[model samples]
Target: MTVSPLVWTLTVALILGMLVYDFVFHARKPHVPTMRESAIWSAAYVGIALVFGLVVLALWGGDFAGQYYAGYITEKALSVDNLFVFLIILATFRVPRQYQEEVLLFGIAFSLIARTGLIFVGAGLINQFAWVFYIFAVILLATAGSTLKEALKGDEEEEGDSRFIKLIRRIFHTSDEYDGNKLFTHLNGRRVMTPMLLVMIAIGGTDLLFALDSIPAIFGLTQEVYLVFTAVAFSLLGLKQLYFLIDGLLDRLIYLSYGLSAILGFIAVKLFLHALHENNLPFINGGEHVTVFEITTSLSLSVIIGILVVTVLASLYSPRGRAMSVVSATEMLSERYLQLPADATDSQRDAISRKLARQLQRMPRISDSLKDELISDRRHYMELLHEVHGEHLDYLSARQSSDDTSSAESAELERRKTAFSDIVNPAAESVGSAEESVGSTAPEGSSEGRPQHH
Candidate 1:
């Protein structure tokens, strides 16, 4: 498939423009995005990707279009899987909700650069060496096995940092605390790295590892480097928005890991088959054409879409998903309500109040009276926090005034000491000089004769 330079330039320009708009409008300010805001932007991005796919379908033949869609869907599924790790990383870092978007945006940007390099290298290798597919297939198979093991164990939390993060901590003086989304901060007059920076590094490293699987999986579906790159790019474009849109919903998708593992396993088999068909190694089938059943792009695309739809539906209806959804919802609501600023805007307060009311109304397990009481208790908590904050300010002011008074008194004492020293030193010297002069003039042999009479 031949793509014109003009098309490439246009695509790059458009993607760059969207990124600029995203930074300027969505991520420019630090705020927890509203459900409505997240939904709109996420839908917009998905819509844009679908429209671009349609354009590809019209320009290229159905075969190429099928390849693009297959690659896009596969990459999209992988990206969602990537989201879980991102969530784990964010939670581990205890990143502030407002700053989460900024961190995600930064991670996405870094991954784009790193993944682009990987894409080129992978493309080059595949073009040069047919046996490279075997390596990609083996890696994907191993990843799928590992993913299946973890999924079956039902372990949700990614407990600790990777080797990359550990190395970063060991080599750099990193703070355990976040400095309001800043990657670097000054401590005791020395600049130090913050957990945010380490989190970004970990995120980048994690994505790079995922690329090992994803790059090969997409290549298996389509050999065209352009399709692979665009599919990956389009899939990643709005991931930041999707992260917020499904922040809690993501936790409820308990079966997603299994679905992803299955997809990876299927793709790995496909890659292995493709490698055998294009065998160049002398040992493999004596360099003969090992004809095998080739998987069609349409079938691959259908299977991927079908798996995703079923996984999503089953996850939502599953017992665990239902139980955890409510628990997670309540936890998030309680946390958000408590952290609501005392000086929050009227609209902000009203929004929270309405959200709480809706949740209470929807929740069947909790009583209406209890919900009402809970809401009132949150209000009381806010008031208490405000009162405490005022008192803290007053105490600080009082301490500062006491310090100022003490400093002034200390200055006055120092001045008195200086004056006393100036007068006393001179007088003592003068007295000593007078005594010396008197003894020298009148005393010598006369004093000795007078002492005999005494």
Candidate 2:
């Protein structure tokens, strides 16, 4: 159904108005928003979108607008799912709370450009070949099935050193710490990249992978390039804020992908039917021509809402929405710490252990089994005792005894950090200090890879 020219003009005006409000009122600062502030802004954005949908219903007779809104809602769902990985990346970076805004802003902007390009590619596919819809359907179906697999298994922690990342690390010089958002730094007449730059590439590269799932899913919604582009564009417009607002809620949305897959499967079938209706081909008799699919705006809206509700409810009610057994090693270390030399006060021992645990947790090589056991694991307790002793040797040992042979090792780490700094990542303790890193204990058993987390 065609809408009046006046309605289109009004919709454009509304879209521009929201952009103005966002720029003027919401995005004045590059700072992290508090929970209350994030909650209010998120609600306001959703309300604005909802109000626009209602206006679409009233003015355009709910036909074209319905499809647009459903597509927007679905795209928004996929964008939220993107945030799940964003959280992991952010936490891994240990980005200072204040600097996260910059990382997120950069990420959102990059994703918008990337997804817009994806939308056009998707539109081209469906337009060029009718059978492309089935390919998209199968892609969506496989991605949807992956949801069940993902739900059943936890994501394995990938090592930071990917081959590409390693090659880049070898190829560039980098800074030791963040140089206040500069992607690269130079020291002693040698140019170096920072962790920030590598992180940015990692994030952009990762988002490109995520787009594989999302582009297909949104295509399942609407084949019209304009509708698909606008819907995806608008859904992503507020994503940086959405990341902070729903950061905590994401862990609770454990079944989120399943919900997304279900919606995509629904939309895939809808688009396929729409394709069949418009097909001029005769060779494929399986294609049934129907003028209109029953998929209206309301039904699409219901599916989106139902998926969110069920996802949230399932996560909330999940019996194992927890680490099978988990506790911060820091806390446990503080609890059982005994003062050396027997007469030391409790406060001193606790302080020492807390400081040491913080230093240790920043190291990545701890076996998860040992990590999961906390202070309760006798083996882990023994390792800590050796590490404390190792720290002493590290401080007193001769500068000549150990190799600092190449400043290249330091240079390489700088390059990795510089390269990755644009994306927030977990803090990495310096590894050049062999004592802090290689502090080893006589193992009760063969300790290799990651000790099994039980």
Candidate 3:
């Protein structure tokens, strides 16, 4: 069935409208979404996708609808897997929690544009050559094997130091600290790219690679360009909300890669069978089409759904999964707490410190080596905090003694002093107590009375 240009235009317009709405209404003001907010918005986006799938059913019949659902599911699962990398990139850049929404929304919009182009290109390739499926099969199979290997090796950390990022760093003057959510900021009397821009670039580059895998995978299910484009777009629609909703539990889904590998491998086999049915290579089968078993869309959907259900259940119940989750959470919490910006509010710092303390209490459940590492990290962070606190005190004392100190300077000093005494000092003391409780001694010269120098 051919879709009219009118229909395509309307569809594209609608998707773009939604993207604009998300940007203007949700991500315009940077704020950390609460659990309730994340869950509600995630569900709303998913519901919108489902309704569009139903529209496909009404307009193009059950067959096209099945294809759409299957393609959407596969792409959505792949998107979830990609979120792990997004988490790493943001954490590596130490993006402020409030500003993460902007980064994610930009990545999603960029991915949609890139994938739409790839979808049309893929369609053209299929129309011109019968051998493209073979190439797609090879790609999916290779990706599947790579994913499986990674899954077996346990969680490996990504430093977001991809060659592209390194190249960008070399080519552009970049700022270490983010100036709010701006991609570019003035530092030392000159404008420079901020980590905000670098992280977005990392995500955009990742999206391109993801499109390479996803376009072919979806093409394996259905060759209809309209369905392909719509499926990919809808899958990405609510991804930012989904990321926030699942980030805390991402490490808990230990078997997700295994399931994705199985799905990709299954699609690869299906693609190979389809390719055989349309064989045109002269070396084998005499350049004639070969008839073979082809997997139906219904069966493909069922298999994908079944694999996901089993994977999620197994991961949630697995003891090892729980342990890994705790370890990852601890590391992330520590990093976030230690990397809090100089202008971060006292409440924000207190919140992170409380979370870190809670994670510390669960330290006994993790491996001894990991626990030791976390303990050392906490101790080092405490010493740094003490040092910063002392510096703030000195600044406050100097300001108090200066006769020219303005009201604004006095007010700022009071705020800093309150933050240090109320949040910073208590946080450092709590970490010290946690370390002692875990049978680790605090480092020498880390006591409150000790004078520390930068």
Candidate 4:
């Protein structure tokens, strides 16, 4: 169905208005959303999406509505996969918990803008060339294969070491520390890019890459530009809240990659069939359309939902999934503890330590069932946890004492800090030490001799 210019204009305005409202009312203040807040807002966005779908059904007929739902569901599932990378990026940067909301909102907004451009480009390609479907089919098929391979290998690519991020770092003078939500800050009497900006760039770049696959996958479901644009926009609208709601549970969905692979592979077949049905290449079938099987939108939606349901249920019930969740939770809590600022309150420290301790207590029960590699990793992190716990105790003791610490106590504290830093980020620690050594050897009055605060 062709959409009118006025309808398109209104739709774009509504999406942009919602984004503005979200930023002004919700994300303007940097704060970690409570679980209840995340849930409520997430459901609200979903409800709005569903209500809009019903409006489509009333005006555009059931066929168009089915296409919209299928496209929306596919895009939403792909967005969940995107979150895995987002979680890694945030953790790698050690973004402050309260300020994560701002970063996520920026990422979401960037994703919408980036994907909207790609969607139009894809539509243009489809309009101008019938052979584009074949290309899209191949892309989806290859992506599915690679996704499955990674799932089988049980390895995730480190987003922190991406070449794009490396290029950005090499091109810009970046400060290691974040200056609140600001992208640039004054450091050493000069302005420098902050980690906050780097992370936002990282997320935005990753979102562009994610769009390459997701756009093709959604187009395979429906070629209508209106449905594609609205589906994708609504899919991303609630993504930030969804991230918070499911962040802790993400690791438990061990079969997610497998399910995504299956979904993409199914969509690939659909696109291939559609390509054959609209064949225009002279080399194949003498440039004539072939009457082959076509997958209906309703069938696509049903299959996608079925696969997701089964995937979630299997992951939740599997023994290994439980073990992996425990390990992941332990690692997350440990990193959060280490990432806490020097001025963190005692209650903040106590909360994380208590959670880490509980995760540690659960580890022994699952240790016998874990693979050797995981067991080794767990052991390594366990040592780090013990050290962190010891440091916490020392900090509490120091706070309790009203007198100044002796040289020995101060040295001991420094040693523990170095040890923790080495365990968590050895490369960074080594680099910092090298810089410190260079500074120590420099002349006293030289700017190079002044220690830089990270």
Most TM-score-accurate candidate = 4
- Tens digit per residue, CA lDDT, model 4, 6-81: 9999999999998898899888888878889999999999999999999899989999999999999889999999
For each candidate, what is the lDDT? 0.73, 0.59, 0.81, 0.81
| Error in Å for residue 118 of model 2 | 2.2
Residue 70 in model 1: lDDT: 91
lDDT of 2 by residue, 73-112 (tens): 8888888877777766765554545556667666766776
Q: In model 2, which runs have C-alpha deviations exceeding 4 angstroms?
A: 1-30, 156-161, 280-282, 286-294, 322-454
Residue-level lDDT of model 3, residues 202-320, one tens digit each, is 88988898888999999999999999999999999999999999987897888899999999999999999999999999986999999899999999999999999999988887766
lDDT value for model 2 = 0.59
Clashing residue pairs in candidate 1, if any? none
TM-score for predicted model 3 compared with the true structure: 0.80
Q: Regarding lDDT, does 1 or 2 come out ahead?
A: 1
lDDT of 1 at 344: 58
384 in model 1: Cα distance from truth in Å? 19
Instruction: Put the candidates in TM-score order, highest first.
Output: 4, 3, 1, 2
Model 1 C-alpha lDDT per residue in residues 129-161, reported as the tens digit of each score: 999999999988998898999988766546337
Number of backbone-clashing residue pairs for each candidate, in the order shown: 0, 29, 0, 0
